[model samples]
Target chain A: MSNTISALPGATYEGAVRVQEMGLCGMISLRGDHGDEKLISAIKDIMGTVMPGQREIVHQDERAAAWMSPDELLLLLPYADVRDALTRLETALAGTHFLAVNVSDARAVFRLHGGSAREVIAKLCPVDMSPGAFGPGQIRRTRMAQIPAAFWMPDEDSVHVVCFRSVAQYAFDLLKQSAHPQAGVGLYA
Target chain B: MMILTCPCCGVTGEETEFHQGGEAHLTRFGPGSSETEFHDYLFSKENPKGVHLERWRHAYGCGKWFIAARNTVTLEVYGTYAAQTTEPPQDIKDTLSAKVPGWSWREFA
Candidate 1:
């Protein structure tokens, strides 16, 4: 049996900011009534945190939950724990009108690190990257150059980006070019 | 370069972040309806120079469809509301009514 691999395992690019592909992180696309008690408790049990607010992301250690929309969420955890987490969610909310599907392989994650992290992302995305406008705990699903992508900051200088696996290479290249040393726009400085 | 605010997620962004879904609040003429009704439903659209209510999807953001009230000529946006609504909200209507005197679109005034 062939071992499962990520779209760009261990891929790294060092420009003004560092871009590294984070391999094989588990992601579950959960859709349901966010106000439902069963769904809330089920997610709390699996993610160890409360459901996030609009465009918010909550994390405890490696487990995290991101509010994707009014009725949807994205759960992030260890790749090996996906099956178990899905089973737990299914069993916990057996009769509820909810959906929990493993989307780990369908997506790719990247970590952007360095002082110019926000500038690199600002060049590609149309979001307000100013410190007061965008900071940690906020997740934005926006167009990254020519593709759809989501990103959140872990701290002041590090950003975590997510995009479809099919566009992993393209997204990486876009980030690489945006992070070129001479390409800094100094908007966020 | 239209700027829109999505009521679903409260994200204000450029038009590139959204996709226009055409006219809003249309009465569907589904199966068993008369041929003319179906044709009008499919082909007919309101092309107003001012104070137009249309459907817009926040395609790159929250992926929710919402209604946008804007002027076609001046590009002035009155407001945006939920797509599930059957009519423009009272405040949006009032805003449009004040800006464009005696403005009425189809059955709305």
Candidate 2:
């Protein structure tokens, strides 16, 4: 045993539409005066890009998205490299008054991938997850699995990252339960 | 089913996640700062024609407390920011100025 947990331990049950997996990925909450040219510059220099691209998947230096405000952005790195990422960025932007909060434990991420995933999410969440309403490369904050979450539906069979980690198992149970009936029981009915 | 439009997440949610922190941009007392001043401080508002920057808690939700700017007249939201921690940016100021003119920056600012 020496395997630290898989950042994404994909959880599954038979005949499920969306893949229910908890990503133990390292998550960071970044806040600062984004208006400060030097601060933004420092971050981009250290991390290559200060802002999450229009899409949910980063493709270049990992993936990220804007959580809400213009001044703040949420940056996610490979679970294992977070400490290194934080320390490097911290020194790089030392005096710029940027704060990097390690929220890996406070929030959990669950990935729901697959075309049937949208239909599965739509059942519990009121937000639009369809290609027409919500498409790839877009991330949105909405209520999901009965918990507040940021939904990043980046593509078909796409990735939907659900945060608020404590609720992950609860959400998993709910999604599993709700989506379960759709897939239906073999002979239990 | 109370629906809260999250500035971060957009207009999609059940009221369960958000906590309403009463009204935003409180009214103040003069230098006199009397008992009635304290009372009025606790209760008063502009509750007016345009955008209002109120505090909302994504309580049961994100557990993060943030402020939301919504227009009372149009019910159109302007923006949101972390509570008590930071001031909004220039774009927000410029947008609000154009949207809600004659706003006393020296006062609520």
Candidate 3:
């Protein structure tokens, strides 16, 4: 958690549920035609790396993930990177028309990293979150509030992620409620 | 419910997979579109209550984007295309060979 707690104003928080404010500055959706080999190379050149390709992600100076289908990739980096990245990317492929959308405000991130985080996330999310099934390095963008959210297994008990900001608060509430009756062993103490 | 055909995985799934693109005629925006016209464009939208071409994503299931011919009137869906693409240089030929993220557009097409 290199980033700090920068509060997002509009969304409400329970405060009752243990919440950690994860400020994900921005999300970039870089889309090129599937067979656009030239564009693919340009993306690799600008990012200094290629997209993981498929349901995988690689973290570098900027976090890149092969989300959904092959033609699209999701990139996450500080808000500062937007200008340079977009400019270099667009200039690199001037004539080639590609889709690069800035979705920082549209998405948010939250980590259920406490001792009971796994138990809580598993009960709420339909996807299998077992330590063995979803370990570090694996990424899945699935539904949480019926809204598309990205989830990744960063560690044994740490499920790091980014989701749509509109439903971020509700998604956090539902996850906390999944462990309502059973409080965290070391959460408060 | 709106049925969105996945361009990647050919099959009709719940409209849940797609993110609703407001109107179909969005591309028709051109020059001399006056301020009033822009107002009408932004505010007064043509929400066809019948069958129309809409953009939706295979959000939860396939993670693909396709065009869904949705009978907004009857709420029945007829078909979906991975790249009813709205982009020139259309057709799967150019983009088919390269691996599409999680799924292949060629395998199904």
Candidate 4:
């Protein structure tokens, strides 16, 4: 049997920050009315936590969920638990105006951290990367350089970013180049 | 780079974070409408040189659609509002009118 490989072959660094792939996480896209009592309860039962606030993330045990939009969320779980989560979510939201799609293989996640992680992200993303503007628990969808991506901060010094699987390598290269400490001087600046 | 705020998520980001949806508050012309009305709806644009109202989607943010009142010439933004409404809010129109004389969008003079 062919074995699965991580989108990123190995860890790399540009400046003070280290960039690495967070491989094979189960990513499920969920959409429903936040105000629906049943839906909220169902999610809580499955996640052991309520839906996160807009642009926020709710962490419980090893599971985490990020508010992807007003009525959408990106649920992250252990790759082994993906099927169970999907079945539970489907059964929970059965007939409602909801959509639960498993997008496990559609994305590649990258983790970046260090003192200059914010600067590296700022160089690639137009969104405010300041601690005051965006910090821990906040998630946002935006573009990295030229490709569409989403990012969230699990803490002040670390950022987790996701992009489509097809352009994972391209995005990784762009991030690596942008994360270069020397690249931020006169020429690229 | 112009900064556009998404009403839904309360995220303010550069124009690159949002996608321009062109002119807003358009009146759609359907099968029963006159040919001119349909043509106007399909092709006619205000294309104002000054203050303009437009639709924008925070495609990279909350992914919510919003309306923005801005000046094309100076790139000054007046305000951003939720996209659920069919017309520009009165406050936005008043702000534009106060900022630039005789400013109007269709009939909201």
TM-score of 3: 0.57
Q: Against the true structure, whose DockQ is highest?
A: 1
Scored on chain A only, each candidate's TM-score is 0.98, 0.78, 0.76, 0.91
- For A1-189, candidate 2 gives per-residue lDDT tens digits of 565553336776434556657656777777876677766675566556655542233333564535444456677667777788788778877777778877776776766665466666666666665567776656666566556667665557655556565666777776776567466332211
**Per-residue lDDT tens digits of candidate 4, residues B1-109?**
6887788988878888889999999889998999999999999998998888899998867778889999898999999998889888788777877888887778777
Report the lDDT tens digits of candidate 4 across residue range A1-47: 66766677575665657888788878899889988887788879888
Top-scoring candidate (TM-score): 1
**Tens digit of per-residue lDDT, candidate 2, span B33-56:** 988878777765556666666778
> TM-score of every model?
0.98, 0.67, 0.57, 0.93
lDDT of 3: 0.59
Pitting candidate 3 against candidate 4, the one with the higher TM-score is 4
lDDT tens digits, residues B23-81, model 1? 99999999999999999999999998887999999999899999999989988888999
Q: Candidate 4 chain A: minimum summed lDDT over ten consecutive residues — where?
A: A180-189
True contacts kept of each: 0.82, 0.29, 0.36, 0.89
Candidate 2 chain A, run of 10 with poorest lDDT: A52-61
User: Candidate 2, overall lDDT?
Assistant: 0.62
Those runs of model 2 whose alpha carbons end farther than 4 Å from true positions after fitting are A1-10, A53-57, A181-189, B1-18, B30-32, B43-109
